[model samples]
Target chain A: MIDIYEIIGLIAATLTTSAFVPQVYKAWKSKNTESLSLTMYLAFFVGIMLWLVYGIHLNSLAMILSNTATGFLALILIILKLKYK
Target chain B: MIDIYEIIGLIAATLTTSAFVPQVYKAWKSKNTESLSLTMYLAFFVGIMLWLVYGIHLNSLAMILSNTATGFLALILIILKLKYK
Candidate 1:
């Protein structure tokens, strides 16, 4: 059975990672990413990459899933920044 | 000796977590957080908490350090949101 901690983790992951959705939508709709920093996203991208590797090493599905989605979201922003900026 | 992957993880952690500095500075300087979302920050805070637990489990300094810092930064934003909004 799932514990309270796991439930909390799932909820947390769902919310935080899903938070990117609005930003992604905003960027996509406005097609303006002037305020978004590329350097920050790049760094975040790399960070997520490492987290993915770490998840793989640990065989943690939650980490892998969350980071993979987050990485993709960050990548979208990065691409948008490059394209629109 | 640390491997290449560890070095990359360190750099990623430093950059992404440190990226919060600019946002924090902007919020602090302007004393305006109208644009920041409270729900997002709250969600992020919880996510970081889980990541911290995960880091502890794996004894991964990089994960621990990055998430701890990010959690604090996210908390700041949450507080600022509550205070300003």
Candidate 2:
């Protein structure tokens, strides 16, 4: 049974996770990482990975799913940054 | 009492949240949003705000604190984007 709070968390998770979509897309399209911070992305990626692990421990589907996606997106950005630079 | 899991969550939360500090600082210092994706930040900000609310509902101190900070930082980035642009 999905709790109401989980629903809220799911919504929030979706928003935050999808938010990076455009960013990863844009960077890939234009190969422009001039405005994006590599350090920030790297740190964020690492953090998200940890969160994903934490989510798994907590049995949170939202956290696991969102962090997984965010982690992937951040990885793309990282690769894009390196490739473009 | 803070259990080991909470401690891990707290650490993960701190890392993920604070990860954006350098980013916000760099934008503020360089006044550069060129690399930063406005849409991403905007979406991320909204998401973080929702996460904060969700955290409050869950009674997770780490989530509340981290999301609060991330939300604020994202806001700073957003304002910098508009102002610099």
Candidate 3:
């Protein structure tokens, strides 16, 4: 039986994970990452990486999915910031 | 006994939670959120809220603390975005 709460977790994961799309799109289109803070994203990436580790420890699907997805997005932004500036 | 992994999670939470400070400071200092995506933060806020709920359900201290802390920062950014633009 699928837990409704887990279902909610998945939905939440989807929402948060997809939230990076617009930023990535805009950054890709504009070729500008001046406004995006590199420090924030780097810290975020590290944090997400840790979260992934912790999630794996707990065997949480939601944490795993959300962090993995967003970690990639943050990497993109981080790379963009590096390439652009 | 405090689990070492849980300690890692707390440190990770602190890293991620503190990541927002520079952003809020930057936005507030410049009064420019043109670079910050409102949709991204809005989606993130909602997602974090859900995570908080899920964390509460599972009684996960790290998840609860991290989301609650970051959620406040995200809200600050959201409000700043609205105020600036």
Say which candidate scores most in DockQ.
3
Off by over 4 Å in 3: none
Itemize residue pairs with steric clashes in candidate 2. Answer: A35-B34, A35-B35, A35-B36, A36-B35
Candidate order, DockQ descending? 3, 2, 1
* Candidate with better lDDT, 1 vs 2: 2
DockQ of each: 0.47, 0.65, 0.70
Clashes of each: 0, 4, 0
Model 3 TM-score, 2 decimals: 0.89
- Provide the lowest-lDDT 10-residue window in model 2 chain B: B1-10
Output DockQ, candidate 3.
Answer: 0.70
Task: Using TM-score, give the best candidate's number.
Answer: 3
Off by over 4 Å in 2: B34-39
Residue-level lDDT tens digits of model 2 in A1-85: 8998788778889999898788788889998888777887887888898788777877877788889988999999999998887
- The alpha-carbon interface RMSD of model 2 comes to 1.7
Whole-model lDDT for model 1 versus the true structure? 0.79
Tell me the deviation in Å of residue A5 in model 1. 6.4
Chain B, model 2, TM-score against the native? 0.93
Model 3 residue A39 lDDT score: 82
